[model samples]
Target: MLGSIPDLLRLLAVPVFGWAAYRDIETRRVPNRTWAPLAVLGVVLLLWDTYAVVTGPTSGRLFFVQVAISLGFVAPLAYGFWLIGGFGGADAKAFMLVAVLFPAYPTYYLQTTALPLEPSLVGVFSLTILSNTVLAGVVYPLGVAAGNLVRGRFSWAMFLGKPVAVERLPEEYGRLLEDADGFTRSGLDLDALRMYLQWRGASLSELRAAPDAHRNPDSLPADPNPPGDGSVVTDGGVPASGSPDQFGTAGTADPWGAERFLDDVEGSAYGTDPETLRAGLELLADADEVWVSPGIPFLVPMFVGLVAALVYGDVLYALLSALGLA
Candidate 1:
């Protein structure tokens, strides 16, 4: 009965994490509603499972101790990652949920043959999941580096990211890879740009008003929305269905229909107001290209790590064994 409950929870968690990852990829935000219920259900299932198998004083004590260690250790570690910006809020919460739901590997899902590692290490499912996640995450950068080399885009930052036209920047999930630089600028500090824009009195609205001069003409996305017919594509590429606005028409406040393209550029952490947009425009005025890092949502890798942990057991143990160090 104890075995069946965790196994069932594992089945439930996969789809939930899968959906969360999908949502994160599209919108870069996962609703708290999605996680809250999963968290509650995980706790209830874990408690019931623990109760079902607490046969006597010794076994009950062992179960309680494991629970304490899982909560005490994993919660702090996840919270630390969040505080340090190593993981996002959603990612941290997901880790805590996994620690509660499957503090150890679900043995019933595995083969009859014993796991290669010592039983103690196999039991800490959250640790194994974290290890697997980190290992999987490493592949992305390596792949990016290899692709950059193949395309002759080699540079100091090529491994980290490539340049995209400012207008082509994805509003949903991209970060300015650069701090700040411009010929008219004395400092590369983001705050300095903010102050400069304040001094100049350049507003995002004014920049939006004159899109042709500031925005890259060559980088403009081809208007998929027909004039006065189809849904208007906003700056974030979200369709303004049935709205009056249309792309690539003349005499509109934004002629290029490029308002949505600069949404993130305007509201970046560098600054969220008009000054940030002015700063971005200044940087663009001095350079043809700007580097932007692909904003990877952490939930994507966590879900992958969970599946990997289940199928492969402990990633570190497997690696050590292969290296003849275990």
Candidate 2:
């Protein structure tokens, strides 16, 4: 267990570092106060690592090789991430600290450090594709499964992290950003902005006629409960001339499209805060469910491909006796 301390530290740092970056994106300000402490922590950890190297049970030569090689591996990674805006300054610094903390960050470089340029290049290409495919294949399918199993998965989120919801329709056309009530005098509190669908209708039936009713799929909800007789249609009055039948399209043709037409009926009639709140509440309560994927579900294999250059070196090592990179 003690031997895994560095790995544990590295793993722990990811969420801390990533969440801080996320907060900055949300607030448009990355507070120096939060990062100052992490910077100090990084320094302390690096110093501790150096001290451990000097005093630990490992032989001096073995320790030196590990430290130097690890540093070599991480330097390039840090430089690359720096070149891309994907990592903010704080994120990069924290990443370096994480690399130092684990000691394995650089050691992973051993996979390709000594290979001939040609084979190493091939491995790099292979690994890059592998890693990307792995991440996408893993993250996307997982998100879908999780989305289906858990109805409210992030449903209550108003601003919803980074996915800006569009509420434009026949009445409020092209005014999505203007109509958004996400920002308040107190500033953004993500909970305030649960996703909402609005339609222009004096009565629920007219809402089904909106032209966009069939195209935007994710915006629609699944089958909704039938509305009560004396329903309060959505605010701003429903359109006088629109109804799903006016468009002459079969209601059941597309599940996604059908949901749009249904939302109009639901929202137009049951359009009050209580109705919206009730539906939103029901969805939000389902958040605890875990979405199960429809596959072997292991994502690590994809990551193995991200740095495919390792395979090139591995092949060379196996065939040419070249002690190349990992």
Candidate 3:
């Protein structure tokens, strides 16, 4: 019964990791609500397993010792990664939960075949998953490098990135990998400011309609009077009635029309927190096209790691043995 319970629980992990990977890919954010149920389930099963082991056999004490070692080692290691920005909150929580769920290899699933190495090397399921995850992560960069080489743009530092038109940048799919060449303003977080603008319904067309509007009506110079309705104005003293095409068209040297539209929005909305707005505008002005890296949604790799641990045991152990190094 104890053996079957962990096997079933290990199967349960597939759906949980799948959902997390899907949500991470789509939104780049994982809600705590997703992890909570899995954590609870893992904890309950862990306690039940602990009870069964303690009551069962001479090897029961060894089971408890393995649990201690797995939890003691993995929990702090996950926390350290979180502290160093190597792992996101959700990723760290998932790793620790994995230690709780599968304190030892799910041996019931390994009925006929033995691991390539002595079981001691990957006694803990969490350690096996971590090793698989690291191997998978390394493969990703090599794939990126190969693609860059094929494209004839083989720079060592930039092999993982591709140039993208600013207008084509998805709201959250990729991160701007390079700083704007000539842009120097610093204060607010540009990413947050972009999110704020979208939330406020301050669209590009609306900002283009009145480029000189400021959040504060008093900041306008004498040349550009605030519209009677108190709409924000641009910094260049341009009123709302000006032409939208003043910012330039797409695919040209001055192909930052969208950015300039955003700049007007920032200038109009610029208030006590103008520094962030200024920094964002400067970043936009840095280049016509910017290098962006489609960031690896970590949950995808976590999911892969879980699946690999179940089917292959420790991948590194298998590889080393196959190469005659083990």
lDDT of every predicted structure (CA atoms): 0.58, 0.36, 0.60
lDDT head-to-head 1 vs 3, winner: 3
**Candidate 3 lDDT, tens digit per residue, 94-177?**
888888887887754345654323343647778888888888877877787787778776443355566666544424355455
- Candidate 3 residues lying further than 4 Å off, grouped into runs, are 1-3, 109-122, 182-193, 196-280, 322-325
Q: Give each model a TM-score.
A: 0.68, 0.32, 0.69
Summed backbone clashes in each candidate are 2, 28, 11
Instruction: Write candidate 2's Cα lDDT for 16-53 as tens digits.
Output: 54456455434323455655655565556567667776
Evaluated with TM-score, which candidate comes out highest?
A: 3
What candidate 2 gets wrong by more than 4 Å, as runs, is: 1-32, 104-326
Return the number of clashes found in candidate 2: 28
lDDT of 3 at 197: 39
How far residue 11's Cα lies from its native spot in candidate 1, in Å, is: 1.6
Which candidate has the top score in lDDT? 3
Give the higher-TM-score candidate: 1 or 3: 3
